[model samples]
Target: MDILYYLQTFDHFIIYLVASLLLFGLGTFLFKWLTPYSERDLIRAGNVAVSLKLLGKMAGLVVVLQSAIRSSINLIDLAIWALIAIVIQVVLHLIIEHVFTRKTNLAKEVEKGNVAVGLFLGGISILVGLIVAATISY
Candidate 1:
């Protein structure tokens, strides 16, 4: 293969990579904003439950985004789908916090380092990610 040809392809790859990173950052910031409590503060206080939940969200977002990137026909398509995926994730989080755990306050529980709540949230996120990823198609 011609070295120059390989080098030229790097430009588009770099662009895609940068765009993906930006989307990921935006999604994460949005998640923080949507939540009722400060995840950062909870994690700082050594809350393993909060940490696990956050980790799951991050992992889920990446999986969804990876699907969007792989199945997108163009950059614009990727971006649009990414935004949709983010919205879905936020909605899912809300449902988990409010609807599913109606009797219990998930945010409060997580803040108090409840590992059961954290595990549930973490597993839900991963499951959502897989489902969302599977739904994406070119």
Candidate 2:
């Protein structure tokens, strides 16, 4: 029973797992930067609406990650597709904010305990995630 052999066998799995986590963090960071208000702050203040919207964003990223993981042939391939997915989600957020939350401030709405806005954004995020996931292919 060689330790090196076991390590080698698990290297790919470990590498991919770490890479996925890093990608997830990057995706979330990008989202945080794009938004006007502080998600952490809002959530800390017990704002269910902010949490709901953030939940959708996270779920959307997971959907994208699932597609990338299933479709990627290698780590580099995964990275490329993951980045593309991130871009798509970011763009989707912008579109949602502009189209759905147009005439009002999304950040303020969420901070003010607007469950309707939160639910709407959450639904939109999941829908976009499904679309992105379905379209990904190896």
Candidate 3:
């Protein structure tokens, strides 16, 4: 197979969807690492809306990354892949934290136990990656 062809496949699937999952983890760790305030403290401070807001912030960061990647790559097909990746990330995160985990608030779950949160994040990434691979176009 051509190397360019292989790269395209990787960009379409992994760069888009797989990267999104990674960005989620990256963003999560970033905020957790840098913030003086705990997720619970942020919740208690009530200066914000809710946990959904945290997800929103992560989504925004992913979007910014997607935009930067799209600009750098300058390929319509690749940009589409990035869009799919970001959507996969957000959708999967929401699904587990909301649909599967039975937790109304994801922050709470993470606060309860870090290990379980890490597992959930990784599990959702794979689930969403598989779904994106199955559904997205080349």
Candidate 4:
């Protein structure tokens, strides 16, 4: 293969990689804004529940981003789809939390280190991400 061709391929790879990272950062910021409590503070205080929940959200976002990158016709398309996926994940998570914790408070439980609730929330996030990713084709 020509060296110039390989260099061009690498440049494209770098551009996509950078774009994906920026999209992931935006998604993370959005998720934090939508949540009721401070995940960063809770995790800093050794709250496993918040940690798990955050991890799930990150993983879910990655799944959606991957799909967006694969299906997009251009960088702009990928960014748009990624943003839509982030909004969907965050909104659906809020709805699920409200529905499941009608008699309790998800934020409080998570603050108290309720691992089960965290795991459940995380699982729901991943599930939602998978569904959204699957629907992103063409």
lDDT of 2 by residue, 1-138 (tens): 799988886988898899998999998899889878888998899988988988888889889998999899999999999999889988977886888656888778887989888878877887898888788865
lDDT of 3 at 50: 37
- Which regions of candidate 4 fall more than 4 Å away from where they truly are? 1-4
Quote each prediction's TM-score. Answer: 0.92, 0.89, 0.41, 0.93
In the range 46-132, model 3's lDDT, one tens digit per residue, is: 534334445554544455455535444544555556555555555555555567556355455555444455455545555554554
Per-residue accuracy of model 4 over 66-130 as CA lDDT, tens digit each: 99999998889988998898889788878888899899998788879999989888888889889
Regions of candidate 1 where Cα sits further than 4 Å from its true position:
none
Cα lDDT listed for each candidate? 0.86, 0.86, 0.52, 0.89
Report per-prediction Cα RMSD to one decimal: 1.3, 2.6, 10.0, 1.4
**lDDT, residue 112, model 3:** 49
Candidate 3 steric clashes? 2
Q: What is model 1's C-alpha RMSD? A: 1.3
Candidate with the larger lDDT of 1 and 3: 1
Looking at model 4, report the run of 10 residues with the lowest lDDT sum.
Answer: 89-98
Local lDDT at 129 for model 1: 81
Q: Judged by lDDT, which candidate is best? A: 4
